[model samples]
Target: MATFEATAEAAAKNLESGRTLRELSDLFTPMAIRVAITLRIAQKIDAGRLTAEALAADTATDADVLERVLLHLVTIGVLTRNDRGEFGLTRIGEDMLVENGKAANPPWLDLNTVAGRAELAFTRLLDVARTGEVAYSAQYGTSFWDDLTRDPSSGTDFDVVMAGGMERRIREIAEAYDWGALGSVVDVGGGNGTLLTGLLHAHPRLRGTVLDRHAEPALRTFEDVGLGERATATTGSFLDPLPPGAGGYILSRIQSDWNDADVRTILSHCLEAARPHGKVIVVDEFATEEGVRCDSEDDLRMLVYYGGKERTMEQVRALAADVGLSVESLRKAADWTVMELAPAEN
Candidate 1:
């Protein structure tokens, strides 16, 4: 009787914790929404497919199951069902539609895309926890980059998603530094040339090179943006030797995807490329103090996706020290933490 009373009190406390019981236990809604997005239900409804049968036909889904899912969407205010059994989108549902060639949500949420397929590895989080292995490889036979490379379109899609999402941050990084003074810079592992293009656009006198495994995307972006004359793309890897004697080497948001040893190697290459007083500018979002809810969640996502974990500022400093580099300046440019490194004085 006493144990029963204790369990009852614990349950009561849980109810009083302000998170709705449904919110805590309900996984169906999110999965259903993702299905709706993958099936383009919102797009179809906007295009006048108002009945479950029609939507099922359009999406090649089971009519009965799709009808039930539609009803749940209505109950959850994502859709509305009328007396005639026709369905329509509510304001919430309308937001799911693409507008002006931009998705209402990030492209990573669409199950049809590479990022979407990658995030499905989150379902294997338990396996990851037990074995300390990456959830991505367990879900798919290959690592994230390998999967992307196997599908050429997947690589381009992933790059577009990343470049599109970081548009604002790219602009901030461009404005935060004086690229003109550097005269020439190399963006190490710079995918799609998005960051380098922004810098060149912001500083007319600046010339830049992009060193990446694939050169076509970066070269195409440079041409599309009319900066081809000033910018060049070289096919290479940051893990190997980088183009030498650049005024500065920019490593933006790349370190978080690697382990400490690999990160040290990458930084060492950049330092070598930036020798004789050139700077190695590191821009990344470092982890903050633990117990911050958002950072914890993001760290988990990184771990599951790439076997990478966000580093704290002190951890970053220690890695830099290992590579014979010292932090010359650290500041925030918009939402990014920008750290400039120079070789330690002998």
Candidate 2:
């Protein structure tokens, strides 16, 4: 009886400690990730077992700094220490860094790359929460989209990162949703249109318009993916107005960048653009009946970098309802929900 009590109390303590530990872990996060990523540490190990010193020398980074980052990552299960001070990839590290591992996940680490640097701007998150404004704008002196527009390399990397995500997200959608009934679809905030390309491939008859700020890259991606004839890139802000009409709409990974009020504005944009008899599918992160289960580090990471959050399905339903869109079906797919809304079909 006494042992059972002790075990129960320990479980409770672990719950609390686990949450706190998660946030503490966030301190190293994308910086450490990008650090190793920038150095191509995992790639180094793929060749063979190697010492941190040799690895550092080869990568042109200070051995001490690389050692510290590797040790911490090992603590978190991202790297492994071999005999003789050599280093190697842990399963997690391999998933993130191995060549031929994932095509969509690589350019994500180019620190000089737009999305990579933008992700590492943890300090700028404070301004976003404090002022309820765009975090990148105040810190970098321009909007996230604007910075990409000015620099070619940054812009290309950023678009590749987004398109990479689209590669995965589109797979989830095309597999999960019935595509035959839709005549025309709009990918709101679609950049470079690769996701649309994936979706269009699944549904040959469906025409698509990409609503975003810059249409050039998306237009090119569409053409490259062989969806040029059916896909049109329309440059505009979903914040100001979404283009007139569409049978189906996609907002994949679009929300969670703003607080509640801003999300409402985005919802309103979706509402305005959606066809009366149509469906607007929002692909995003959400908590569900299973539980609020993201690791503390991931929670804090999202908080710091994006000034946004993950939400419960109830929260999403409440927000969608408030903006005159009714949740038709919420398909739980891994970490994200494919939410189908139909302007309160009544």
| Highest-lDDT candidate | 1
lDDT of 2 at 168: 66
Q: TM per model?
A: 0.86, 0.68
lDDT of 2 by residue, 1-346 (tens): 1245555975787787775766554757667877787777887878773777888888988989889988888877788887678777777788656432147355546676555656656666666668665555555666566767778666766566556545566677777776657788888888778778887888888899888778888888777777667988988887886876788778876776556887789888878877577788887766444454334445554555455666667777788899889988778656667788888854
Cα misplacement distance, residue 163 of candidate 2 (Å) = 4.1
Candidate 1 lDDT tens digits, 96-156:
8863125566656677766778778988888888998788888888888777666767678
Error of 2 at 19 (Å): 16
Error of 1 at 297 (Å): 3.5
Instruction: Report the lDDT of model 1 for residue 335.
Output: 63
> What would the C-alpha RMSD of candidate 2 be, to one decimal place?
6.3
